[model samples]
Target chain A: MHSPHFSVIFSLDALTGALFLLTAIGVVATRQVLASLQLFIAQSLLLSLSALLLGIALGSPHLFAVAGITIATKTVLIPWLLRHTVSVEVYRTREIDRVLNIPSSLLIAAFLVVIAYAIANPLLGAVDLPFARINLPLGLAAMFLGVFTVVARREAVPQLLGLLALENGVFFAGVAIVPELPVIAELAAAVDVPVVALVVGLLTRQIHKRIGSTSVGRLAALRER
Target chain B: MELAAILLIPALASGFALLPTNRHFAAPMTVAATVVVFILASAVAVRTTHTGRVDALGQWLTCDGLGALILALVALVAMTAALFSWGYIRIRAGHSERRKEQHYYALYNLFVMSLLAVPILANVALMWVAIELTTLLSAFLVGFEDTPEALEAAWKYVVLTTLGAVLALLGFLILYWGSQVAGYAPFTWAGLVEAAPRMPPALLWPAFLLILVGFGTKVGLVPMHTWLPDAHSQAPASICALLSGVETTTVLYVILRLFPVVGGTPSLDARPWFVGFGLLSVAIATLLLIYVRDFKRMFAFSTVEHMGIILVAAGLGGAEAHLGAAYQMAGHAIAKSFCFFAAGAVATVFGTQEIAAIRGLVRFAPLTAVALTAGAFAITGAPPFAVFISEFLIFKAGIASGQYLTIALLATFVVIAFCAVMFHINRMTFSTPLGSVPATALPLSCSATLAVAAIPLVVIGIYVPPALQDLLHAAATAMGG
Candidate 1:
């Protein structure tokens, strides 16, 4: 499988991209809330890995900063915040009721990947970027899948996981697309991610305590008559 | 300095509120901070009216005419809402739950801080973060009631809006990439406009769509407005005032900032999309307002309708149109916040927000009834009200721009929404009482907020203050009119 043309870093990034897509699919397919959270941690890890690979390949310190921050926030801080905030009951609950069944959700998720590539294809053709070819479409696919996960999952933690996954999708694309951004923006973005989790996590705990469940998708009390 | 101080004051107030302080400390401190911010924002508005721009720190902190106008509106609402909270929240929390009140105030200040940050922060990426923070910060405020319903609303609010924000982040990143592709420029609104023409149309087109759909969700554009009603209805009146009033406006401000950037690229046109989505929102919201049973939810739907109208006005194109858009923005903030306050008062008096529950409020709660009636008249675009004038200006501007069809449709929806709102409010206010109720006196701060908010609601429609007129004119020009 070794080719003279493929830089090892590029090949590794492709592998990372593949694993990233897999983790997104895993998030959609998981039944246990804990599994979805675990998948999200893996996905965030994959995201930081890609950032590190891209940072090394592109020789950009900012991507490295992106890598460090994504790990600190998405992987470590978010889970800790959720563990502290969301009740153990939500994680222990199995067989989450989703809007769509897993098999159909996967089929639809597959369709979303095609759509993501179709959407990314034009932009790639429009301007030349070296790494965009690998990262852009895959990042977009993960993002679409993340959105799909959010739609399908009713559990608050998984839903929150879907949201963070969606963000991971954007940064996954961003790390390649704008590698040398002013680290100031990067730092601000870093702060933003944990707050999303903390806020959502705390809200989830409130819902669970008040309503005795975190199946947020099932909430229908506030609609018009 | 004012731009920086406007942000600094709120941040510090939120800090002070968050500290281990007495329960009563947060409300007045927040109110004091907002008063200072209002004065500063007005100073910036006046400065920009004369000078056209105020830059606190290059692109990172800048306020031009449009920014100042939004800043001023947010501050005005924040101050009134803080005042409203002092009385309303105390009543809602009861005397024993002092700590809950303190948390509410702390969250309230941070929420206000996020709204203020949007316009004044010129850097596009940082601006996106600020918009996201608005959702995160306010999520708990929406759930402050800690009811199952409030929790539902807060969850939906955070998850959906944050989803939209994540999507928009990619859009901003693409914009940053486009800027780099064009040659390095700071990722600021001004820099994006400067970089737009040189950017590949492919990049700009997708970025434009992503941001439009993404932030459009937060802006409560229909199909994406589901969470808005829930959050706005479920939140306390003070928070509702900010949520329905300036919070939505502040997010829409971000989407509107894209207009000039998208305008610079010759091959790209965001107008049709703007008008399309705007019309759709207005149409749907008008329909919802018709069947809306809950008064608070009714006001919330009206917010969606008003957002649509402003989006349509912005897309209608021309100086008059943009000016109308600016005017409508100001009018909606003032009137909508008033409507929410009145609704809150009615809800408190009657212990329900349902339209069917209250009848002949005038016979019983005359003061609350009168405030609700006035707010209703103001929001539904009654003659000599700011909404009517701004919407009128928009209609005339549409004719000038030759977008007769869009204007006609918008006019029709606006009228239907007006009738629907007035119809329900009319029944709530003047109709004969179905049941007898004891007379009630509203909290002092709530009454004071309504009276103070009413002044601008009445005066702006009748008289256009010269500096405000100049500021609106400058804002319209900044909007690419």
Candidate 2:
């Protein structure tokens, strides 16, 4: 019975890992800001599901609460806030202007994924923990991809989403390693997320009002004299 | 009595100053509070001189050799800054509202309270949180003016440092994980040091690296130091003094704490990385300082230079080097705070920060001109100042450790930075005033603060107290002498 339960977790972990990779690729390849936001949300949702399944398999009720918070906040509240604050009109009009083209980003993302897998394979093989070795690298790759999105995107919303994605990656990585991190620390982190979201939201409103666009390039006006 | 007063006075005064009443009361109240804290801290240092240590609240707050030195520096400078802000803020009283003045004092107290907490906290995790709280509280202070530029600098500062802190958090987590492997129960400085010998090198190495890079950013090491100049230049001068002087040093103290744990573990030499980053920061900041246009920013860049100096000192990795680093931390706190106070006064008089714009300061404000010149000379490693002694000690340590090239490079950059800074200081002080802005007389508090800050810069150059010597020796010993 324990073995079957482990097998179920293993499959869900694999699916979660694959979804993370896909979302990362989508983040890199997609040039439209709205599409990238959507992909990021999808990635966050998958992370919640993975955390929830792992919690059930491990019989850790706290992780279930973590999962619920992750979903409601990351997948729902944050994206909705981003969408509303960064109005749909702006999202539809502005495409993600990248320094590197889509093909190049995809190629770079592929290279990164390969490097991640190569690094994780031997390391994870030595580790005794279940699913950590695989899940860790996937989470890292998603983080790297999130960073790429942030670097690639010119628009503020996409960059903001990229930051959120990066946090999600870190969260997933933390879950994979120590699924039962002290509840106090976990709650602190959870509380921090929405507060940051709200702050960023306020900043976004200010940015829009001031510049009429939320591009990183224009924000460089305050550089050192 | 000492610890309680150091913590509570600021906390209570800050609470009182936060009341939305009179604009007149804020500055004086803050100054009084800081003075009391400074006096208490000095007494603590004096008491520790005889007893060898001061432990408080069941060892949750401590004044060992290094912490005593830090506490003394923090108290003295914070007190002086508080004094200076009295005159500084008074100049802006008519321009600002009653409420804004109150808010400034409130944030000012909070910032100082958090900085004081960093050196005294016993738990390493608690220390990290306190450092983070310092960032949060000071973020408002940095953006106190709320101008577009100030806002932007504050945002950059908060974002970059917060990111660095998150990495530091991960590093702490990794350390906790490693400690668990080593059969440790609680994660505290004492606990970690006790279990240090058994921890695996793999975990220790990665954790140390993460922490070095993480806290290194807060300390304004190169590449990660982009926010320092902007934020420092934008903040009120008193706060700038705290930010650059004591605040960065407190973060560096945490890195210093980790050295014993990581340095003791064989097969991991963290020195090379520290030296590399130190040299990089020094060289970059030296070159940049030459071209810096803003006088305030020129001072800010010097902070990066000094931090690099301290890092290189620490990287030298010996008892003497550790002592040099400790001395450097103390001296820089005094010298840098004086520099900022003077710079703030000059900025107030000239109504601008541009180096090219402000000239003939001596004719305009002779006292400020003298203070700026003296501060510039002291900070640029001139003789008869504490920074010179500390830098000399560092170079000597570097040479003794066979890091001849590092010492030579450090010297070259120091020279370059000196020339860059003196060039501007000379121009600003000696040259004819560009405009007809009269030399407005400053209030008594401002001159007193500058005098207090300046006296140490001059005195420590010529003499090292026995207690300070003992404290530095002990701190060095704590670093694994």
Best by TM-score: 1
Q: Which portions of model 2 show Cα errors greater than 4 Å?
A: A1-4, A21-103, A115-127, A154-161, A187-213, A222-225, B1-14, B40-64, B90-96, B438-444
Write one digit per residue (lDDT tens) for candidate 2, span B55-154.
7898878776667778888888888888888878767645567777787888788778888888787766667667777877788678776666776677
Q: Relative to the true structure, how large is the alpha-carbon lDDT of every model?
A: 0.89, 0.78
Q: What is the TM-score of chain B alone in each candidate?
A: 0.98, 0.96
Tens-place lDDT per residue, model 1, B1-481, is 8888888888888778877777778888888999999998999999988887888865468988999899999999999999999889998898898778878887888888889999988777888889999999998899988889988898889989999988888998898888899997878888888999999999999898899889999999988999999999999999999999998998888888899999997787888988999999999999999999999999999999999999998888788999999999999999999989889988888888889989998888888888888888888888889999999999998987788999899999999998998899899888989877754568888888888888888899999899999988988998998
Going through the candidates in order, their DockQ values are 0.90, 0.24
Model 2 docking tier (incorrect/acceptable/medium/high): acceptable
DockQ of 2: 0.24
Alpha-carbon runs more than 4 Å astray in model 1:
A1-6, B19-22, B438-440
Give candidate 2's whole-model lDDT: 0.78
The candidate that wins on lDDT is 1
Q: If you assessed candidate 1 against the hidden native complex, which CAPRI class would it receive? A: high
